[model samples]
Structure formats: structure tokens, C-alpha cells
Target: MATPSSPFSFLGDLFNTIGERLQPPDWAVHEIQNRAVLFLNHVLQQEPEAQQRLLRQQGRVVRFQWRFVTMELVATPAGLLDLAPAGSVPELTLTVTDDSPFDIARAALRGDKPAVQIIGDVQLAAEVNWLVDHVRWDVEDDLARVIGDVPAHTLGNAVRRVVGALRQFVGSRTAGKAGGSAVGPAGNAE
Candidate 1:
């Protein structure tokens, strides 16, 4: 008896309430953003080529947007990322094309790329694409540094297995939603 928009409307209201309740203080949000930048720089450091690319992009800014969230990052000469100053214009902007965070997470878990809309500089976009295609976090290596190599290897393997299982389960559920056959990201039955 419920209308098609009912569920979506409920979800929207629920998210709004949650967002209002979970909103952090300005300082805490700034700190979290700084930490994210540090983590990104850490990952960038792992790949010399990526670092070099970023270095080449020094002084340029890239704005990223995912629905209501927005962050503008500036490329530092040291091949690191820093939060851009307020009101700074970005050389390029990357907008996540997907509206659903659940779908984005599922696609990421499946090792698939989320759709994006690129605006502005082509060179900057290409450099960003290269960084995305190349940079990866070596979680196992970091774990090994904290714990031990053997434990880290075992943990990493276990995590990978669990992720694989989840991917399969989620994929199957999505397929079921699409009439019992696997559906591509483009909604094509596969």
C-alpha cells in the first residue's frame, strides 16, 4: 500500500536526522580532515611515481565532491596533500556520479571503480587518474610494522578471504534484485 517514494522519503528523513545528531564540532571535523590528508599522503609516499606526479602538480588544487561532502586538496611541492584554503579555486573537480553510498561501497568491495564526473583541467584529471590507478595502501605492511610479519600475513589473508566472501554474497543479492542474474554496473544483465 506504500508509494514508491515512501521508502526513499523515509530514508532521506532518517539520514537527515542522523546527520544532525552525528555532526561533529568544527575543530573535530577539521582534525579528521587533516588526518585523512595525512593518510592519503602516506599512501602517496608508498609509490614514488605517484609522489612525483603529485610533485608535478604542485600548487594546483583538486576539489572532490561526494553528495553533501566536499574537500579541496592542494598539491604540495613535497609531493603531499594539504587542505586547500577557503575560497581557493580548484584546477579540476571530481564529482562522484553515484548518489547512493551503499552502491559505492559495494562497488569498491567488488574492486570496481565508482563512476565520476570530471570537470576542468584535462591534464590534472589525467594525473589524478594515474594516481588512482597506481596508488594503494599496504595495510599488511603497516600491520607487520606494528605486530609481526607472520601475524600480519595471516591477518591479511583472512581479511582478503572475508572480503571475497562478502563480495560474493553482496553480488548475489544484487543479482537477485535484478531478477536472478548478475547485473553490470551499467544495469546490463550479465
Candidate 2:
């Protein structure tokens, strides 16, 4: 089984820093657990810490909702943690769904929490592969927020941002001296 989240790893330090900030109402603690494993693939893009990260991210989104109890993985050093309530999970229609490894992984990283759950009947367009899973929802929603409606161009923009972030992240992980960093001998490949 996986360990607790890296984000929460710093919670002790965090709470200590703001211990006297505010106390929540008793009723506020009553929440339902609505988290999952795949939604985090987009945020981390590593595809390994699916459950721990995605579930946390999910928890965060639903936290402020009427039935809040989900965590989410933000693309920061500290992975999954508390998220604001997501309200109702939106219903997005996936063109494909077969529940295969890729399908499962996609759903794991892409399915909405009780929202647009990608089933095994829909199909995935090749272009969809370019996006990070967690950010996909935000990317989709962001475009919808900016433009009165989602045009073909907006979808491209979202994908572009996801790809850019992914490339930048991966680049840093594998960057060289030319990239403004040098790999230590232990960090370098044999």
C-alpha cells in the first residue's frame, strides 16, 4: 500500500505555523469521502502515485461542498492534499471507454469524481493524449470560463498549456548543464 501524501507530510509544520488561524465548525467536519486514484496523473504526470495523489486532490475539491471529503494533487513539490469543494462533479462525455490498461489509466487520471466518469464504451481521440489528466478538467473549465463558450481554439490552448507544463517539468527532471543545471554523479545515468 502507498504511504500518506507528501503534501500532508508537511501538515505538522503547516498547522503549527497557523495553529491559531481559525477553528472550523463542528458540522463542517462532517464530510463524505469521494476520492479516486487516476485524477492525479495530470498534476504529477509521473503516473506512479495515482491513488495517493488523485484521492487527495479529490478530497480537496469536495471539502467545501455540502458533502465535502476529497483530496487532490496539485503540481507542486508537496503532492496531494486538501482541496476546496468541487460542488457537483461535472458530466463530461468521453468519446471512448473500454476499461483497458490505457483506458483504466486514462480514467484513473481523467475521470471526474462521480462526475463525468469515463466508461469503457467511449473512444479517445489521438489529440487527447497530449493533455495531463488532473489539469484537463481545469483546462477545460478554464477555457469555458474565459470564452463565453469552448471553441476549438480553446481546447487547443488547454492542451498547449498541459503539454508545455509537462515538457517543462520533465525537462527539469532530466535537464543538463546546458539547461542551466548539472546532474550529480549519483543523479546521472550510467
lDDT of 2 by residue, 129-167 (tens): 223333334455545557656574667687778866765
lDDT of candidate 1 at residue 171, scale 0 to 100: 74
Q: Against the hidden true structure, what lDDT does model 1 obtain?
A: 0.87
lDDT against the true structure, per candidate, is 0.87, 0.39
Candidate 1: lDDT of 129? 91
- Candidate 1: residue 164 Cα off by (Å): 0.7
Error of 2 at 28 (Å): 3.1
lDDT of 2 at 29: 38
Q: Please give the clash total of every predicted structure, in order.
A: 0, 29
TM-score, every prediction: 0.83, 0.24
Candidate 2 similarity to native, TM-score: 0.24
Per-residue CA lDDT of model 1 for 1-190, tens digit only, reads 6524646557766876787578778888789889999999989888998988889999999999987678899999898899999899999999998876666788988778899999999999999998888899999999999999999999999999999999998877666767856565788754
Candidate 1 residue pairs in backbone clash: none
